[model samples]
Target: MQTLNTLRSDARAIFDAALRAADPRLAVERVLARRGNHLLLNEIPIFDFTRGKLTVIGAGKAGAPMAQAVEAIVKPDDYLGAVNVKYGHLARHHAGVISNSARDGVRAPTKFILLYEAGHPLPDENTLRFTHSLLSLLEEQTENDLVLCLFSGGGSALMEYLVNGITLADLRVFTNELLRCGATIYEINTLRKHISQVKGGQIARLAQPARVVSLVLSDVLGSPLDVIASGPTAPDSSTFADCIAIVEKYHLRETFPPSIVAHYERGARGEIVETPKADDPLFARVTNVIIADNKIACDAAEREAQQRGYAVQVVSTTLQGEARELGHDIAARIKHAPTRTCVLGGGEPTVTIRGSGKGGRAQELTLAAAIEIEGDAELVVMSAGTDGTDGPTDAAGALADNTTVVRARALGMDAHTFLENNDAYHFFAALNDLIITGPTNTNVNDLMIALR
Candidate 1:
């Protein structure tokens, strides 16, 4: 009863369920509510609405919708906020404009939070500008104010403020090098914390004297509070020494910008103040809460597959390592899986760029998987990011089945050649198998679904 078409459709359905579970708005709503002139987080009153002016701030792919969720609970003029998101990811309101609209049949003048679009996976001039603006807003807060930090994945790049001597160009160059070197997000963010003015709890420090609460939609596996989006509103368990170690571990000293190297070294030597540590007293007023993560998405995928009559196995939520190797391993597992089984894995995998290839981790994984499942008709694999983006590609990810490589071969494309070149985007595009879902407005790592 499990035909190829059925399996493919079921797999997509399962992934969609996972996306819904990770919806930024719903996730925020689940943890935040207002009860009788007090803002309650998880039923505990954190802010007295009558005593403080509310301000929402932070950045990420989920910033816009997360802001919307907060807006739904608070009055329009009660809070002023700003968030930087990746390009094309915005809520219903136009950027930087306040528009009036009716929600739930109530005519309300919505004070649109400043949602600035900027580059992601890499920082740009707009990233710096937005960070400065956020700092200015933070400076305006007083003890009689409430600050909510809406943070998620991509925030590290979407909201950045360089140190005194480090230029935006320097941060970009080092970031590109760190990404291509297959360094983990933790390691990359360790470096990012040292060079930025507002990361690793620095933002929390800036918003001092005001009660700061962060609602996080985590993209990092294990949802480490200090690692996700470089933990702008959390504590710093990572240090300057860790940053130098990551640079040396990746062998990026030569390629990293000179100012970056100096910055890290200076911080390590205590010439510069380190990021706020876990023991910092400033953290007493700052509370970081993760409302959604990869496990939530993977669990949702499992339930959907089960509803579809699949013997679902959520393999792992902390999936990592080399993308291609993971793909091949997944393909082998699916080959031996039972006829009506669905296997789900979720996490952000790493890809070391050895070639001038143009594909993200998800695409590369699918292409490698295709080569392994070649000529087998009973298996299908789909790997994609929840954020609707994989690396720099337009596609969320790619889909591959037994016929993927065979079809590519017919079209004069060799799977091995493309895999070797890290050109899975083009290879999948040729077969019309790329999964394009532009900016899902959320991030919880990625999901890999395989059916047999």
Candidate 2:
């Protein structure tokens, strides 16, 4: 039987392997192939090397890495591009190619491409500026141009072009309500798609005459393109009616920004232009493909577990719902796993922030799991975001072992009290169990691993 430390190490090993297997580098390389004169995406020739120029633009957690891969494959003189990633995501690199200067800082980017860093999970003023720049570039392209769009998670907030009538403050308040209301990614994006000019196939519209191709690293469950980063380049199936319904379902009208509500009402009433739908003509020259997602990470973790001589079980790849309650449920699943077995899962989970806590969903779930598995000596579990930062906290998540409960009790900390207060960051911090990896330069959503 494996010892407690061994289980912990094994679970982490599986996680690292999972990240490597879902490496944005590999995903981009596989989907994009350069032929003699044409650029092929999964065997479909989407760009001509000999004819038109290529304009690459993207925004996401994986933006830097994906752009680097594109630069490696394409010619420097003919490619014009840019990307918007979260801060620190591209500190060492940017849109062109990352090379260190004599001063040990990233060399300045070439004139052809610009890499801008912005906010994530929420957009700042910089996001507005960068989004407009990208839109200007795309909108200026001619019919002969090929636009390469590399997208991943975090793109939504990092790439925003506010509608003309809406104030940034109004959008901010509206976003805060959607987050606190426990809406799924789909629901949240549904509203975002209707409110923004860049999302919900507007990028495709902006790049109308140009042949556009989008390579996405999906962070949404089931790899739905329309919901990934609010489907900036793909068709939107949601409507203004759906947006109003979601707002109503969450009872957000009172606190939800009146401007946002007014926008949705106007759009629903056909007084304002709607987001491009599936039948829109803008999709004629567009191709959006998901190159990587959560299931790939889960599959890789399972393979690593089996290789390590553990009886592996792939419970689910699209886990969802509340964080703390699901923690108890996952704890029950781990408890039933036989000794020397490993369990792997992946998906985005939500935490309702009723308390003024500092932790993300990953930390909150593990804190809840700690409550259910208090005394066993050989079990260990971890729930971490693949992007390496959970919520606003520095922790990617938390780790729990059989001794976790007692250790906390000894420190005069009540796990239940913390969980209720949504203070999982402090709880795990006190126990020295918070997993900190920092910005991983990639985002495929959250991953959870359990060993028994």
Candidate 3:
């Protein structure tokens, strides 16, 4: 029988291997090659440029690699326009057009534009300006063109554009307030869709008459099209009423924008437009295909665990709720598991920020697990965002063993106090347990594994 320490180490190795296996670039290429250059969703090929010209207009953290894969398939003459991508993920050859500059591209058919490397988890002026240019590019499209939209996670922040009468400053304030208030990504995007010009199926509407094929890399729980990057190129099932209800539920009426308030009021009265629905005509010519999701990553992890001689059990692939509570629950389960047993879960978790301390969902989950796990059950827990970024911190997430609790206590660190202050980043950083991978160039929400 393997010792607890050995089991923990094995689980960590499996988790890391799983993440690498689910790389966005690799997934895009594999899925593309498997389905061929033209992907079909619901018997509709996403792109049929045999007659008209093909163009690419997309925005997301994984947009660069996705573009590279598409470029490999399409003819040079058939490829038109640009795809906005997160900084540092651009291919070497395509890096010439955009070089991490904050300026937007004006040139038509621009191949590579870095646009800006604004802060993550929050949008900035650069994010707004670049997004405006992206929308402008869509407006340039004619009915003879077909738009290949490469959408992935982090697009919501990368493509921030406020509706008329709303200021970016207001958005920033509202966004910061929501983060500090510990709102879920779903709630945050609902509010954002209500205030944005290009979110919640508006992009699909803008590209009307011109066909759109959205190649999506899902990063949200359940892989809902409407929640991934606020579903810019997909129809929205949520409404302004849903947005208003979320704000009121969170008691954010005081901080809510007056213009936003008016927009919702007008929308409620049918004076303003609502987002396109499932049966809307705008999506008649549009198709969205999910190229990758959390289940793929979890399956990879399970395979690695089984290969390593561990009995692997996938607890759930759509886990949700408070990170800390989930962490404790996982720890408790692992404590009773027999040796060489691995439990896995994948999904996004919410954080209700009561602490002023800096920490992400993954960090908080690891800290909570550390406190609940004890003895030489050798219980090991690992949780991380598939994108290699967790919150505002550079660390992907954190890993912990039984000794983590004692180690923190020896340093005068109180787990409950640290958690209360929302300071998991500092606490985990001190112990050198932070999993820093910079940008893995993929986003599929979060993954967790416990080995016992």
Candidate 4:
């Protein structure tokens, strides 16, 4: 008899395989290569070092390793700039980052670019500072320059520059409102572009005349270029009217600050310029390449599941909707699924917070699934973020087998009460069921796995 513990281990191994496939450094390395006096991305000659000065800039959770990938191809002396990453994401690249002050009056010679740690899920003080640093670097570039931009999940918050009249405080509040209302990443980023000077192709406009190449690791479902990191280097298909429509759809105007409401209103009235459109000549110099995404992660999971001796089924690559709802749907599927089978899924899910609870979409979904599949010995389900951090909690997500509820009850814990409070973190913590892989240093979205 195969125990749930064994199933859980297999599921975790499969998840780990998915993370390895989505590694930001490896993803960039696969597409980027160097040749004698020339550079190639995906085997096409894209850059020539002798033509101009090379400047690298970007923002994301994977920024540090992506920078390391670029460094592997471009000499540190040949390129210089900065990238804003979420706080504590600079894994093992401490020697490569330029610090604020030199303790010994000598900076590391290998340090050509600056990596500034900033707040995430929302922009903070360091976000503003790093944005200023990157813009100033762009200001020094001329027609004979090459700008390489790295982007991945979390870049929207890791990098930001507010448009005039919209304060950081207002932007933070507006972002929180959008998140709590279950707004999609596309809609949230659409609104972000309107209020930020550096997003929605504005960065490309700023780097004009200089050729810009952006290597993206997509976290959004469907990988719409304009929505990722609010399309800092891609054309914006969304408009101010789109922003207004999103607000009206969510009834967010009432909760939003006056400045936010006024800014988009002015933008719609032609008082402010819209984000760069697809026809904009500025985009002629920009190239956005997706190096990795959820599909790649899910495919890896499928292969691993097969290697583990389970019949595999890829459920979906574009999964969406509310977390709790998706949880129930997944549980029902697993219960009806054939024995010795592994069902794999990938996509970002939304969590609409109704209580003062500490949990992300992945954990919330797993909790709901646990309740639905309680008392069934033939199923085990796990959902986790590839980035290794779910929402604000330290745990990436959670793993629940048929034994989950029973184990919780033995410890005097109730799944329904925790679910009601949106407190999945504590619920899983008590049972030691949380999948805690701290900062896998990459993001392609989330992965859901079930085995029976």
Candidate 5:
């Protein structure tokens, strides 16, 4: 039988292999190709570059690396595009990042392709500018032009152009309020679609007559195109009525900004046109291809686990609900599994903050598991975000085992108090158990592993 520490090492190695398998560069290189003079996406001819130019526009946490991969494939002179990525993505690379430079501020190879750093998990002033630049680029497109869009997680807050009368302040307030209120990505994006001039297939509308091919890296569970980054290119199935329901569901109708509420009110009343729907003729020229997802990541990890002689079972790919609660449940499952077995789960979970604590969902989940698995020295559990960030913390997530809680108590720390305050980062940091792989440039979702 494998020792507990050996199992922990194996689990982390499997998780890292999963991230490598989901790399955007490989994903793009697999799906996109230039055959002779024609551009093909997924073996289907998307454009005749002889008659039209190949243009690109995209936004997400992985936008920079995705764009870089496309740049390596396409004719440099033929491709002109811009991408909006999170702030720190452009400035740094850690040990895990493959880089030509040893220091920060590494320059990209694409001279014509522009990359802008924007906010994430929350929009900032630069977010509007990023979306506006993308919109302006689309306006320059012609019927013969082909639009290549790269999308991944973190695009929702990275690029946003709010509706008129909805100021940036209102957007910031609404986003902050809804984030802490425990609304799901679907619910939060429902509100965003109604308020944003750039999202909800509006990008497609603006790029009309131009064939749009979107290569998406799925972050949301099940790869629902309409929910990923608020589906800026894919047709939106949601309506203004849906936005109101989400607002009411979170009790943000009254507490949210006034102008924001009024915009939704007008949209609900049909004073403004709805986002493009499934039956809309505008979707005729658009194609959305999900090139990577959480299931793909999980499947890769499962292969790695089995190769190591562990009986592997993917518990769930659509794992959701409270972070702490899920940690407990997954720990219980590990205890029940056969000896030398690995349990895996992937999906973004929500955290309902009961106290003012500093931690991400992945950290909170690991800490909770630590407490639940107390005294069971044969088990190890770990959870991490694929993008190398969990919430706003520098570490991706945490790893804990049966003795984790006892270790904390020996150090005079209360694991329950830290978990309650949503402060798992500090707890794990003191334990020296944080999984710190900075900026993987790929995001499918969170992956959790338990070995018994």
Candidate 6:
């Protein structure tokens, strides 16, 4: 059996490799080099942009790096602007506008502006400002322009512009409630699209005559174009009625803003404009490509495990559900697997916060797995966000071993209580199990690996 420390190291290395493989820069370059300015439809370049004014506009955790990669390929004159990335993720060429000084002989456009960095998992004033700026940019586009949209995870919160009647404060409250309720990304995004002016095909409509090419780094389980970043560039299959249904189903009708309610009601009655459908003319020239996804990350992890001389099995790249329950399931699987085997799973999970404890899904999963795993088989389970941030915390996620339970017991702590309180951050912090890799500048959901 491998030593506990060796297993822990292996888990960390595998997780890091997975994240690097799904890096926006790598994926964007790989896809762009193969199919230049042309839109690759099912591995075939269907729409070639040999002569057109290329304008870049997108928002997400990976927006900066993805933009940087695209910038390397396209001329500086062709680039427009992008927003809402962690600090310092932009390339040297684009750093002048974002930074205190200039570099790479590339000047940040005086017309293009990135408003500000806002809170993650929660939309704040900065989110509102940046979103409005994006909308303003979209409104300026002409029929002759070609828009290259780079989208990844975290764009939902990053691109936050509410409809005329809704306020950012109302959105903040509703988002907190939805997150605490453990709402899925699809459901949350459905509601977000209803209240936002730029989401749910609104951007696509705004860029009406302009041909749009969306290059996406998939952080979602299944790379549904309409679901990623709430499908700002793609056609929206959902409607305001769908949003109302979700709120009603979750018993959040009473808690949501009256404006949100009224807007949906009007939408249902055909008083308000609905999201553009798949067959809409707006998407006649639009193209969406999933350049990378969770599968890429999981596959990279598997390869790393094999290189390290461990038998590897990728359990699933579409793993989802309650964080704690998923932890137990993974632990059970590890217990049954061979001593030299490494089990891996990728995809985001939900945390229904009942307690006032501070924690993200990955931290909670690691904590839960810690409680269930106990043996001398030298098992180490680690969970991390591929974006390098787990919820609003500073740590990427958490790591634990078979001795984690014993360690907690010795510290007079209760793992079940921590899990119940959604205090995985504190629980892992106390044990010094938090994995911190500040702003990886890429996102592909969450990754979990258990080494035996």
* Per-model tally of clashing residue pairs: 0, 0, 2, 0, 0, 0
- In candidate 2, what are the lDDT values of residues 273-350, reduced to their tens digit? 888888988798899999998988888899899999989877788999998877888888889878887777789999
TM-score of each: 0.95, 0.95, 0.91, 0.96, 0.95, 0.91
Winner by lDDT between candidate 5 and candidate 4? 4
lDDT per residue as tens, model 1, 1-452: 66888877887888899999999989989999987898999999999877888888878999888988888877545567788788767754445644221111111212457677778988888888767777777776789788899999999999888889988888889888988999888888898888887899999988888999999999998999999999998888988888888888888889999988988888889999989998899999998899999999999999998888889877799999999999998998898887888888999899999878789999999999988999886789999999999998999999898888888999999899999888889999999999898889999999999998
Cα TM-score of candidate 4: 0.96
RMSD of each: 3.6, 2.9, 3.1, 2.3, 2.8, 3.5
Q: Residue 159: error of model 4 in Å?
A: 0.7
Tell me the spans in candidate 4 whose CA falls farther than 4 Å from its real position: 93-110
Positional deviation of residue 82's Cα in model 6 after best superposition, in angstroms: 2.8
| CA lDDT scores, all candidates in order | 0.86, 0.83, 0.77, 0.87, 0.86, 0.79
Per residue, candidate 3 scores C-alpha lDDT tens digits across 171-255 of 7777777876667778888888887878898888887778887889989888889889889888888888887788788888787
In the range 1-452, model 4's lDDT, one tens digit per residue, is: 78777899999999999998998889899988888877888899877788878888988998878887788776545677688877767755454654442112112222576777788887787788768877888876777788889999999998888988888899789878977899999988999999999899999999988989999999999999998888999999999999899989999989999999999999899999989999998888789999999999999999999988899978899999998998998998889888899988889889988888789999999999999999985699999999888988898999999989989999998999889888999999988889998777799999999899
Estimate candidate 5's alpha-carbon lDDT, on a 0 to 1 scale: 0.86
Off by over 4 Å in 1: 92-110
Which stretches of candidate 2 lie above 4 Å from their native place? 91-112
- At residue 103, what lDDT does model 6 achieve? 18
Judged by TM-score relative to the true structure, which candidate is superior, 1 or 6? 1
